[model samples]
Target: MRLRLKGARVVDPGSIDDYKDIIIFDGMIEAVIDPSSPYPPVMLDSSDPSSVTKGLKSEENDTNYSEAGKIGVDNFPVEEGDTNYSEKGKVEASPTVSGEGYTNCSKEADITEIDLAGMVVVPGLIDMHVHLREPGQEYKETIETGLKAAARGGFTAVCPMPNTNPVNDNAQITAFMVNRAKSLGGTRLYPVGAITRGLKGENLAEYGDMKQAGIVAITDDGRPVENARVMRRAMEYARGLGIPVISHAEDLSLAGDGSMNEGIVATRLGIKGIPNAAESTVVMRDIALAELTGARLHIAHVSCEESVDAIRQGKKRGVNVTAETAPHYFTITDEAVAEYDTNAKMNPPLRTEQDRLAVIEGLSDGTLDIIATDHAPHSLLEKDVEFDRAAFGIVGLETALGLSLQLVNNGSLTFDELIEKMSKKPAALLNINNDIVPGNPADLTIIDPDAFWSVNPETFFSKGRNTPFAGYHLRGEVYMTMVQGTIAYHRTDGGQ
Candidate 1:
C-alpha cells in the first residue's frame, strides 16, 4: 500500500524539510516532496481525527499521586461524531502504480492521501531500554501488548531488557523473543541479552551466540553486577562481539531496602531511602571499567546530579560512554512520593528539584546522549500494595513523548533537539540509522504535538496501569504510527 502524509512538521535532520509531503510505498519512504509541488491536494475523509486538532489543555507540572483507573478495553477515548475505524478514511491505494506516484513521475490518485494538517511528524522514536515482561511474566505484558503501547507513544522500535524468568542469556531465548515480536506485527523489538548466566552476575553468557540471534546489547538489568572483575570480563567479551555493555548502575548495599530517593522526603515519610550516591558511585565505577576495557558502556536510568557530572566528565575524558534518563526523572521529583505513592517508586528513584534541573542541563549540554522511557510495566496486583513493599516501576511506554516534550515547553530543549534525543541519538546508540529519505524503511511516527490529553492509565494499551503522571494534563499525542509501511497503530476517531 502507498500513503501520502501531508501538512505535518518534520524537524528530524535529513527528513527532507520543515514541512513536506512524505510518500511511502512497499514498506519504505519513497519520497519527501515540497508541499506545493505537483501532486493531488491531500484530503482526509472521515479520518481518524487524531491528527486534526491539538489535544486538551492541561498542566505538565501537576503533582497528584493518585492511582489511575482500572485497565479498560479499546481504552482510547472516542470523540463525538466519530465513525468506525475500518470504514472511515481507509487508504485506498492501488497496487498497480506502486512506487511511481511517490516520485511525482506519475499520477497521484494511485495512492491513499492522509491529510496531517496541524500536526508534527518526525522519524519514528526509538527507546534503548524497556521491559516488555515477556517469556515469563506474560500476565504483565507481551511483545504484542507492549509494542502497542510503544506505538501509541510514537515509538517504532524498542529494546526490551532481558530480566525475564529464564533471562535472555542464551541465543535460543534471544531468538525466541525477537521472533515472537516479529510475529506480533508491531514495534521492532531488539532483545538485550543477559550479561551473565541467568543474570546471576558470575559467569558470562553466550554473547557471540546471542548477537547472532538478534541481541543488540547485553545487560543484567533489574539488578546491578556486584562483582567488578566479572563485569569487566563481560565488557571485554561484549567489546569483542561488537555489542555495547549496558550497566544498571546501582549499589545494593547503599540502596538496601530503599523504596524512594534518600532525601528529606524519605525521612519525612519515615521510609528507607536510597542515596544519590547509590547510582552515581556505580556510574563512576562503570565509567572507569569502560575506560580500562575500551568497551562501549551505557548507563541506564541516570537520575542524580552526581551521576550527570560523572557522565559529563567521562565524555570529556574520551571514554566510550553514553547515558539515558526516563521521563519521570525530568518531569517529577522525589517530593511526588509524599503520599506513600508506589507508582513513583522506580529504581534509581526520582531525585530532588536540584537534581532534576541538573538532568535538564545535561540534556542541553550533551552530557546525556539519549532519552529512553525505561518503559517498565508492572501489574496492578503488584503495585496496589504498601509503597515500601510494592514493585519498583510504573508503565511509561504511552507517556514518554508527551512527557519529554515538557522540555521543549520549558525551553530546556528545542523541538529539533527533542526529536534528536528521542529518535536519532537513540538510533545512533544502536549503530542504526532511520533517516527519513527514499529507500529507507517506512518507520515513521506522526504526532500532533499540540494535541492535549490527560494521563489516564485506564486508556493505556499495556497490561500495566500504573503511572506517576496520572491525573496530570499533558500536551502532545501520537496520531499514527507506521512500521515498515504498515499501520501498526492508528487512533481511530471513527477503520483499517
Candidate 2:
C-alpha cells in the first residue's frame, strides 16, 4: 500500500523541520517531498464510507488527514539527513517508539492520501515511563486501553513499567505483555522488566533472559531498590546485557506515611508531608552507583529541585545518567492537593511551585533529557478515597502532550525542542530509530499547536479517570497518530 500526506509543516526536532509532502509505502518513509509539489489527483466516493478521501473532517479546516489513492512515480528530492543515518551501533534502546510508521495492506492497492495542510507533522511522541496495569490489575487499566490513551495523546509508543499484577520480572510475564500488546494492536507497548524478582528488592531478576524475552530497560519502579548492594548487582547485570537501569528514585522510609509535598499547604492541612530529600537522596545514591558500576542510570519521575540538581551534577561528573520528569511535575504543584483531590496525588508527590519551575528549567537547560508521563492509572476505588487513603498516582497519558505544549506556548521551549523531548529524545534513549525521513519507519504525529480543547476524563480512552486537569483548557490537540505506517488514531473531526 502507498500513502501520501500533503501540505503539512514537517517537524522532526533534532532531525528535519520544514514543510514537506510525505510518501509512505510498506510501513516505511518512502519519501519526503517538497510541499509545493502538485499532489497526485485523487477522487472521493462520498457514497462509500471506506472510499479514499473519506475523513471526519471540516472543509479546509487545515489539518485533517484524509486518505489518498494513486502511486505516481515522480523524482522527488529527499532531504540529505533523510538519506544519511548513523548505523545503530548503540545498545538496544528501551522498548520505545514506533515504526518508520507503516503497516502494509496490499501492494496493488490504490495510494491513500491524507492532507495535513496547516498542521504540524512531527515524529510520533514516545513516553518512556507509562504504567500499563495488566496480567493482574485490569480494572485500573489494560494494555488495550493504555495504548489507546497513548495513541489518542499523539504518542505512538510507550514503555510500561513492570510493576504489574504478576510483576514482569521474568520471561513469562515479559512474553505475556509483548504478545498481549500484539493482540491489542494499537500504539506500540514495550515492557520494562523488573530489576528484582517480584520487585522484592532482595534478589535480582534475570536481566539477560528478560532482554531476550522482549524486555527493554530493567527497573524496579513503583518501589525503590532500598538495598544498595542489590541495586548495584542489578546494574552490573543489566550493564552486561547492555540495557539501561531506570530508577524510581525515592526513599520510601523518608517518604513514610506522607501524602503530598512537605510544604506550607501540608502544614496548613495538617497532613503528613514528603520532603524533597526522599527523591534527591535516592537520585544521589543512584548516580554514585552508576559511576561505580559503569552502567547507564535513568532516573524516572524526577519531581524535586534537588534531584534535578543532583542529576545535573551527575552529568557534569561524567556519570552515564539520564533523567525524566512528568508534565505534572512542571505543570502542577502540591497546591493542587489542597482540595483533597486524589487526582493530584502521585508517587514522588507533586512538589512546591519552586520545584515546579525548577523542572521546567531543567528541561530548558537540558539537565533533564525526556518528558515522560509516568502515566500511572488508578481506578475509582483507589482514587475516590480520602486523600490520605487514595492511591499514589493518577492517569497522565491523555494530558502529557497538551500540557507540555503549554511550555512551548509560553516560550519555555521551542517547538523543535518540545518535539525533541517528546519524540526524538525518548526514542534515542530507548534505542528506537524513528527518524522521520526516507528509508525510516513512517511513525509520525500530526499536531495542531493552536487547537483549543478542554480536558474531559469521561471521554478518555484509558479506563482510569483519575486526573486533576479534567476541566483545564489546553492549547494544542493531537490531530492524528500513525504507527508502523498505519493510521492508529485520528481526531474524530476532519483535520481540515
Query: Against the hidden reference, what TM-scores do the models get?
Result: 0.85, 0.86
lDDT of 1 by residue, 1-496 (tens): 6787888876675444477777787898876765533232222244444221112112132111010010011122234444332232223221221222243323444667789898877888998899998889999998889999998888999999999877999999999998998888878999999998988988999999999999999999998998999999999999998889999999999999999999899999998999999999999999999999999999999899999999999999999999999888988899989998888889989999999999999999989978999888898788899988999988898989889988888889988888888899888888777988778898999887777778888889988887888887777778899899888889776211
Give the lowest summed-lDDT range of ten residues in model 2. 84-93
Q: What is the lDDT of residue 383 in candidate 2?
A: 85
Cα lDDT for residue 435, model 2?
84
lDDT of each residue in 170-268, candidate 2, tens digit only:
999999989988887779888899999889998888888888888889999999999999989989988888899999998989999999999899999
TM-score of 1: 0.85
Model 1 segments more than 4 A misplaced: 14-16, 39-109, 494-496
Q: Scored by CA lDDT, what does every candidate get?
A: 0.81, 0.82
Using TM-score as the measure, which candidate wins? 2
Candidate 1 Cα RMSD after full superposition onto the native fold (Å): 13.3
